[model samples]
Target: MTVPMERHIARTRIRDSRLGQHNVRVNPGEYFVTGDSSVMIITVLGSCIAACIRNPLNGFGGMNHFMLPQSDEGEWNGVSSHMRYGNHAMENLINEVMKSGCRRSEMEIKLFGGANMYVGTSEIGAKNARFVTDYLREEGLKAIASDLGGHHGRRIHYWPATGKVKRLLLTGGEDSRVATAETTYRSRLAAAPVEGDIELFG
Candidate 1:
């Protein structure tokens, strides 16, 4: 499932004047990992998920933006399967962080994204939220915090080195943009059609 790093890694890195740090935007089907204290990883989500994991002791962490819970196929619309699926996204981020001398036992995890953009349609956001929580539990890991399952999108700013995340709910036209982005991306994937009423149990 390992594709070229260029395919999943965010290519654009800019210096944030306000934060005075280098920031990279992780688009859907992308993940970024860095140990630099001056680096920040950011992503926008709508019916998707991003797992921000870091080891406070060593100041090493990363973030992943996944579109779906899982995909058995090898690729989807030219997107790497590993980058688009939660299972592979989590595994890749963890492995990359671990490679930076961070231990799984010492990892500090925070979850974000998973917004239900379409009210009457599939509850893909809820499914993503449930998938990540369950995934962590099965791995014997726990998320320190999470923001999921709402009727809006989110813009996340994460400092992987420090494990500090700032979330901004998409509003106005921005919110519509996020939803449209997800819809466009989702339409490209060969997933099962939404049928019946999908609900998330608290």
Candidate 2:
């Protein structure tokens, strides 16, 4: 039997007040924006990348979780064209922060994820880490710090208002949950490459 969408979502949330009562959890292929100093933004990642960005002066910030870099030739089949790609994701997050009364020059950027979890295939995680690093340099933006390219996953907690981050690298059993989420995400991309609207939870 399938569960109701609302119930499923409620059960999926972290439920820890440590992130604050108004915190938002960003899932793969989606982003969340806010200017509220009291709220937090969080996500878990494996191979995928989540960029935590904020404008210090205005206290506007957001986080985006993207699975891959853009293809130079063509668009992705079913995924939201811009949201799931690194370049577009980065641009969108910045745009959202700016729209909330922040400027690009005052932004504090920190990136997480891109672990080399796959044993045999190409190190997509490494590629992803390298891609973001290069992209920022090319755009003349400096990332304050990054936790990228390792054999482990990450649980990221970002306080947008203060531009503070608590990046916890996962090990042992923590790997199972992140691995499952990433596997399901890739399977969705493979099974149905079509455009659809994504609802924002925050």
Candidate 3:
């Protein structure tokens, strides 16, 4: 069987910074941090969500993406801490930001990505979004802004000092924030499957 062309192409990009940069790859339990940097960017797509947390008073921020809700199934082993599940990802991101000297009360949130990359798969994006909103509420934090839901992948840039978020949509091509085309592209991709695809096979 022939694999689809789209499955072999790169769909994400990470920017370089003079201060330094940290990149987190999917595996259900891996995380990276920029230390005291005032700005952080996290990109995500397809049944995935990125939570951007910033402490305006401290001028520090962090972002994390999780692919699932929680690792209750025990298939993730010990690395479950770094995976992009809703509950674990949220708590870990918050804790890490606080440990870097950010106070919970002083921190603001800007959420993005959680795209419904997969069609007819139980609406994972909506479920992930709900999990994030509920987690924030339970933790007594407020979301200053958000660009979530829909079927388009997003590239999210967050500035901690200013608590500003910039969202760029991904349509398997040039980057922009257009909603209609991106949504259509995502739907098409979700409906196709490739044989022997191992990118996320674990």
Candidate 4:
């Protein structure tokens, strides 16, 4: 019952950094990809999963934020959105870059977020970490960097063409916003279209 990624990634461009360059902001359950160097794709997360991937040769790169690791869990509003799932998020991002003149072997990957924001056995963060790790291994890919598993949130900045990422840990003033986001996502999960049997890690 998580919100669709497409809902958060609005087309309206906004300036997110001091460099004065145009950037796109992605909220929970959303993803963004681009080959444009000027557009810096950014997002904030707490216990959410986001994969930053790029192909240097083709200057194509992008990032995605997913709440669930798998897509076969259940449906939301009678629809199963693969984009909101980690597996599909990775698939979508990788395929787009590959189509832009990159290969799987040349792809550089970086992972972020997946923090234990709340106390629970769901361990969504850990599951997300495991999911990403397993997926990479299955694809025969290696990670250039990863900042995962902790009690804090993170703000990630990624450069697709260069495959460079800047991860800033979030604290203090960020608690409220992160809490709000978590609440929103959880509320959606509570409103599951399947009524039961669906598991959400957020």
Query: Which candidate's lDDT is highest?
Result: 1
Residues 29-125, model 3: lDDT tens digits:
2343443343354554554667777556555556676655322333333533213245556676676556555667777787776666654766766
Q: What is the C-alpha RMSD of each candidate to the true structure, in Å?
A: 8.3, 7.7, 11.7, 7.6
- For candidate 4, report its TM-score: 0.78
Candidate 1 residues lying further than 4 Å off, grouped into runs, are 1-8, 69-84, 191-202
* Superior by lDDT: candidate 1 or candidate 4: 1
Q: List model 1 lDDT by residue over 1-202, tens digit each.
A: 2211222377778987997888889988778877678888888988889999886776777788887733445654564453346666788788776666567787899998888878676688887888889889987889989998888889999986677789999888998888888887776654643222222111
- TM-score winner, 1 or 2: 1
Candidate 3: stretches off by over 4 Å: 1-30, 35-40, 69-84, 172-202
Best of the two (3, 4) by TM-score: 4
What ranges in model 4 sit over 4 Å off? 1-12, 16-18, 69-84, 189-202
Error of 4 at 140 (Å): 2.1
Residue lDDT tens for model 2, 98-196: 655555666789999999887777787887788788778976788889889889999998877788899898998888788777877866754543344
Compared with the true structure, model 3 gives a TM-score of 0.61
lDDT preference between candidates 2 and 4, better one: 2
Question: Over 4 Å off in model 2, which ranges?
Answer: 1-20, 69-84, 190-202
Clashing residue pairs in candidate 4 (N, C-alpha, C atoms within 3 angstroms): 5-29, 5-30
Candidate 3, poorest ten consecutive residues by summed lDDT: 1-10
Q: TM-scores, in order shown?
A: 0.81, 0.78, 0.61, 0.78
Model 2 vs truth, CA RMSD: 7.7
Ranked candidates, highest lDDT first = 1, 2, 4, 3
